[model samples]
Target: MARTRCDRTPAWAQLQLAYDNSGKAFDLRQAFAQDAGRFEAFSQSAPYVFADLSKNRIDAATDKLLFDLARQSGLQEHRDAMFAGEKINHTEGREVWHVLLRTPPESSQDGSHRSVELAKVHETLNAMLAFAESVRSDSGITDVVNIGIGGSDLGPQMAVIALDAFATTGKRLHFVSNVDGHELAATLKTVKADSTLFLIASKTFTTIETMTNARSAKAWFEAQGGTDTARHFAALTTNVAAANAFGITTTFGFWDWVGGRYSLWSAIGLPLAIAIGAQGFREFLAGAHAMDEHFRTAPLEQNLPVRLGLLDLWYRNFHGFTSRSIAPYHSALRRLPAYLQQLEMESNGKRVDAEGAALPFGTSPVLWGEPGTNGQHAYFQMLHQGTDVVPLEFVAVKKPRHALASHHTLLLANVLAQAQALMVGKVDAGGHKHFPGNRPSTFLLLDDLTPASLGALIALQEHRVFVSGSLWGINSFDQWGVELGKVLAKDVEARLGSGDTTGLDGSTAGLLARLRA
Candidate 1:
């Protein structure tokens, strides 16, 4: 599919005019008062997620123009290209086939003609799951530590923690992602070498932070008289030779089609597989696959991802909102904010379009948040009455995994009330008690936070990001921004060891000297 930047479209100009005419003064309160069916008109129900977008500053006219913008930008064709196995990740020359990882083996038989890739996907999946089950059944290994960074860490860590109720009862999962020694050190203090199984996760088995942690773990294992290297250690990487050399006889591989940000469905999810076991892991994948099908077949008007993505673009380009706050109400979903931060920021944080041309407008907004109620006390103040207008996305679960009805009811009440309060502020005689109404928020409700629901929810987020990026003309699959830091860090590390600040800038040189001293 040929790339078309959104700003270059006629719909973009029309949308701008549309915004100028009535979009700027879009009052959520007035819209509700004027339209009796405003809530039902904007709300949508998908496989496992329900979204209420009536609270957002948008209406029927805005929706039509936004859908027009999506059409003008060739979003439909672009989405088709993705599912058709074309290399939409133009720069990387790889297909964005994370969907394949989630698809069941039987799906290949349905005239999809993805049998070859599907076979490979299931091969690795079966092997990885067998290994995970074996590890889970082993009573000796009580702890599993995953050493990886970025997608390697965030996706698996977040999913495992989110689905902790389904995790192996006897085992504890630990994630070490930070390059700082403190994180790994603290994790090491909790587990002995004999009882812990270390999983090294890196596509090349050569990420500096991952390898550094891997080596430290190996050193600790050897020092503690642990000898079963092959049984105790595993690698999630394509570099078989390097993993073999590292004493990892068990290794699972994935293709370049899996970008780091979108790799949770791949072998990088081994930790998640281990935690949830093979059946639960399959359910997770099945949920994501359902969402993939929805994104593939649903009409633009009814598509959840399309609607959310269009709203994101509308807020960023027209409404001039700079950030979107995510408030997942469940404590089990605490890592969701961080997971989305990397997912959205790393995927679409681009200055240049797919054709390597500079973009005239902003792409991804600053996505930030904490779990609800906790944030209500912290940054909720700024969100409620701050000078800048920031949009909020609230994710709530209708059914609780726990039996605490009182706690769950209170939690749900707080989330609903917060959304209501954001839109309907109170006017008081005292300045401190007064609140200006008409703030915008989006509420996403799930029946439960089961593996399937969480997977669908995350897939919903991933596709929405893809929609916005595709329209914006950015390669949502590639991340060149993260490369510079690694290269510079190598130079700085050499300088640190050698005490050579000769060519260093003033601040770096001073910091190096202080560190040495």
Candidate 2:
């Protein structure tokens, strides 16, 4: 695979021209007042997603330039290559095909050939769902301990909590991601081994944090006289041999093409499949597949992920925005920011291109935020009155999943009002009352928080990450940066036991002493 850097084109030059001229002073209020059709012109619908981009600081010329930038950057070609199973992930020498994982069995051209892989996906999903169903129905098994980190823990944990209503299974889900033994110890105190099922989620069955936790859980289970090892312990890992060696007979596997963050559609989503059941899990895949089809077939001008990615490029490269705040209004989506933090940061947080050449331009921006009302009480002040002009992405749901009518109305109102407040601030004649009303924000409205809609939303985010990473000419799949920490941690752990300050940094020595003391 040849690694090509996206060259600045005529469209980028035109964008520079536009940015110098009228686009620099693009104001949302003035644009809205000047154009009655601003909202309709800017807002677009795709499947379960509706975007109100009129709240953003962009005009038609801005969008045209963005589209041009996309063209010049060869975004369409990159996107096409990914869908066509080309090795876009140049560093990994593999095709990025998490989308293919969610593709239904019947949708494949040859079911027999595809059956092995497709059946594995469905089989694990089915088994996990059966386990979740049994646990849900059983009054005895009240606690589920998910021992995994990063993608394994975040995706399922987030979705299970979000769709709490659909979870009539009555099992409390506990996710243990940190390597801290205290976390595992705390979880162990609440449930007995007989009542708890530990889902050890690791793609390689060798992640240090995951394996450490799994071993500790197993030790605790055995020490506590937990007899049903096969019944209580299940491994969500591709390395069946390693899992079996670890005394885990029940195991599930996913392919190399599935990145950890994108593995929820594979067996890595066992926890989610267990919590939501086979049908709901299928709906989740179908939701993502719907967005997949849309992304594959939609025009560049009308594409949601493309448009968002283009805006991301414009903000990061041209407008000089450093970070993005993701504010999901629904409490269920409280973890959306963390999920995206990994999705965007891990993918595009690279200093080098595919060929290991240092990049001249910026790649991924720092992404951070909490849920809406909570964030409003906490960091929304910084967002509104902070020194930086951080762009905010507010995700709101049109309909509520629960019957709490008043709470839903208040949530929607707060979301809408927050966007409006950001755009049209209260004017004050006094010095302290002065308000900067031109803060830009984008509102993404979903019809409901169903499994399918969640899948679509997540897939949309995945593709957007792909767009930015592709345009930046970086490999989004591989995570070489994560290794340095692991290596350093080993040295630190040894130093901690030895109390040796020799050849260690002053800060490290001090921290080690403090920890030991």
Candidate 3:
């Protein structure tokens, strides 16, 4: 089927009708009371993750309609086009092939998804892994600082922290993304110049914030009388000439097809690679490859990502939920919410469709949350009592790596109680104490938090975002929304120095003058 915007599909009208008739009033508590098999019907198990979607405000009939929307919207075709490397990122005129970074060397994609790139992909993969191993073995390097912004920083930082249990290299992995001098300054005080290895990550080796931090780091290295630039600094960028000019002898490069948000699986993962050993890193890739294959081969009805994406669309368009709260029950995944904020928002936060036409429906929802138990004390108050029905996603691991069984048991109990409380709330008390029942939520449980499980979870989210963007008919790979402020920043930076606010707006000009003064 040809690619079709969701609104253009016949199923779209049917969905609207369903929402008007039953969807608006569909309650999980009521649904469960009506259907004995609701949990079994709604819940599903993927490769490494099991999702209990029964608590979500969706019924079997509405789910079928959602599946119809997915089919009519040409989601399957769009997904296939991405895997085939057909320049699906039409706005940028590039293929979205970050999936290639995870594919095994022996994996046969014969006559499929541009198999010829496999040899090239593995060559870089082998080299990057070798370098990571070298870094892991180096006793002199006590700290490895990754200096990059956006995808370069968030992806690796999230993974490194998430898989902290797997990192046995006795090296501190630090990430510096902000251009704020204080952030870099604070990090500098923590590590000796000679003991630190800085990985400068920028696709072009000229990203303003990354390069700014990189230059400052270099300056500090020299200021501390540490003169060996080649030994201490490495670049994760394609601009080999620029890296060379910057006085870095070691470098790794990834393709333009790898979007910044999706580049982590590429050499952008060097920090994560160095944190976990070569074997663990490869297992990470293997885990993601397993998910990639599942996405490539699974049927629409059985596909985990498809279900999530369609449900997200339901919440955004029909149900009118404007935001989602991501509550990871594990402390180690504290960065997971921030990582997903970039992953989903940067990808689908668009005002227009792929054809440059304005879209009638909303694209991305506001996603915000902290690690659970912590969040249970914060904004979760509003979630229970507020008028707005923000959907919540609870991620919990079935097993804990730490031996604190009592703490783990308490954590698990809280996560379960939270989901249940949201769905089956108390209301017998008077108005002030009454708890409204039937708040929607999804529970994603992993058997254990390992390198492989983390890989699978991230890949699942990547594909889920893709499915939603595909149905919306937007170029999810390109982030043109992020460019406008950047361009204005350059003009404003110059004005801050010159105090020339000639054509600037009153607000900007006044603010610039005040800052300069």
- What would the per-residue lDDT of candidate 1 be over residues 294-378, giving only the tens digit for each residue? 9999999899999999999999999899899999999999999999999899999999998898988888999999998899999
Worst 10 residues of 3 by lDDT: 106-115
Better of 2 and 3 by lDDT: 3
All models: lDDT? Answer: 0.92, 0.84, 0.92
Candidate 2's residue-wise lDDT over 1-517, tens digit each?
A: 2324554467766777787787678787898889999999888998789998888878888898777767777778878787766777777788787887887765543545345556666666667667656766778777889999999988888888777767767677899999999999998898888888888999899999999999999999999999778878888888999988888888777778788899888777777766777788889999999999988899988999988888888888778898999999998998889999999999899998877889887889999999989999998887777788889999999888778659988988999999998888767788466557788988899999999999999999999998888777888999999999899988888888989889888888888999999
- In model 2, what are the clashing residue pairs, if there are any? none
RMSD of 3: 1.4
Quote each prediction's TM-score.
Answer: 0.98, 0.95, 0.98
Give candidate 2 misplaced runs (Cα > 4 Å): 1-7, 107-140
* TM-score of model number 2: 0.95
Tens digit of lDDT per residue, candidate 3, span 443-486?
Answer: 99999999888999999999999999999999899998888998
lDDT (C-alpha) at residue 393 in model 2: 96
